[model samples]
Target chain A: MEAFITYTLFAMLVATALAAVQLNRLFAVVMLSGVFSLLSAVLFVVLDAPDVAFTEAAVGAGISTVLMLGTLALTSRTEKSSSRSSAIPLLVVIVTGIVLVYGTLDMPNFGSANTPANTHIAAQFIEKTPHQIDVPNIVTAILASYRGYDTLGEVVVVFTAGIGVLLLIGRLGRRGERQKQIGRGE
Target chain B: MRHHLILRVVTKLLAAPIMLFALYVQFHGDFSPGGGFQAGVIFAVAFILFGIVFGLDKVQQVFPTWIVHRLMALGALIYGGTGVVTMLLGKAYLDYSALAHHPEHGQHYGIFAVELGVGVTVSAVMISVYYAFAGRPPRISDEEW
Candidate 1:
């Protein structure tokens, strides 16, 4: 039953992706992309990755969709039709997709126990977490205690990205005042 | 948007619950599927929904840009500070065992602090990014949307 649900969700994801690619209206494209993310979240759940599914649902569907809509507000709603030939780009895309699909062929089966991912350091984390952190959730234990520095680095990266965005487009201090003045003039 | 009676009413009713849920995800992360990143996005979603319905100006009034900016830095500081505290306690950086007599207690404390830091920064950054994008004089007007 779970496998059935997973296949159904994958089918929906493919349809949504195709629709998003074919649509010229940016609004519909954005909505379809949101649907794509939500479908991926369901797939994550079927795969028993609830933590990842939660993040995908919140960040991908919720935040990204809103951000994309905001971008659409600032840009054109409809995609501009390019007169240039699309043959080369299409070929490149096809080649890349083929290469990616080929690469996945060597991957271990989804939940196989003997896979490298399951055999490597994961064994120690599972074995020692009860004695070390004593946390009920192994995911939290690995992320926060075992790999604290990495998570701290991630937080710093997020902070830096925020600052970069603020520097580029944030209406702050004098810039905000100027924007307000421009709004009034309009 | 100002005249969208149902949207305004529903948004107002939903915002608090959304925030409450974010908090639950943030604090209950150790035992559940959620964590700071998800909670942060959820928190920002509440504010973004309000901004969409009631207008950006009102949302800004409630959560000013300065606060968001400060929070973005503050969260990173909190995460780094936890590491620094551990180092000061004569343990390696980010060593939670230094925080308490029992290793488990220290781990709990360290994780809670860092998760709070992560949640604060993620939500603030998400909000600030939204503000940067939406605060601009939109190319399309409200009627068009």
Candidate 2:
């Protein structure tokens, strides 16, 4: 059942990728990219990382698609630059994909109890967490408590990205407001 | 747009719940799948939705740019202060063991405070960034990137 599900998802991903690449309209490409992200999130859930899956769904399918559409609004939404797609970039992409797939061949067998992650300090956190916090979700316990620092750091990183965006757009906002006031005066 | 009557009404109704959910995610993070980062994104999304449905100018009116800037720094300050309090109480940096009279309870108290700080900073900054992006000034000369 699991193998069938995984194979189906992989097929969906391939179809989506082909759709994204072959689409003539930039809008269609962006929308197909969103579809691809949703499939990837589903795959993540099937792999037992529900938290990661949730985030991928939220950020990848939701926010990223919105951002792409917003950018699409300000620019041409049709593929006007297809003349630039030549042999070099395509070869580079193919090589990178091949290397990545080859690297996955040496991956550890699935769900091994004696795996390093399951037997190390991580195991202690995973094992003791439920008793300490009484939370059924062991991942949540590890993130919120035992490894809270990393989570805090991630929050700070997100906050920093927000600050960076604010800095970049601050002047633009003021100018926009001024123009709005000027328009109202007319 | 003002013409999108459904959007306007939905956004008005959703604005409160989104903010409230962010708070819930922030506070209940210790027991749930949500935390500061997720809360921040949702909070930002709510305001971003408001900005999109309404005008950026109106959204800015609701949360002025200046307030957002101060919130960015304030979040870090609150987070650091918790650590400072722990140190003052003779524990390691961010050692929530000192947050309450009893060490175990203190851990809970400390984590909550820090998470609140994280949530506040995250929500504010996220909204601020979206405001920056959505509310950008129209170009005098049309250009493409």
Model 1 chain A poorest 10 in a row by lDDT: A168-177
Q: Which CAPRI quality tier does the interface of model 1 achieve?
A: high
Give the best candidate by lDDT: 1
Model 1 DockQ, alpha carbons vs. true complex: 0.86
State the lDDT of candidate 1 residue by residue for B26-115, as single tens digits: 999999988888899999999999998988899999999899999999999999999999999999999989999997899999999999
Cα-based lDDT at residue A186, candidate 1: 100
Native-referenced Cα lDDT, model 1: 0.93
> lDDT per prediction?
0.93, 0.75
Best by DockQ: 1
Off by over 4 Å in 1: A173-186
Candidate 2 clash pair list: B100-B106
Question: For model 2, what is the error of residue A5's alpha carbon versus the real structure, in angstroms, after optimal superposition?
Answer: 3.0
TM per candidate: 0.95, 0.84
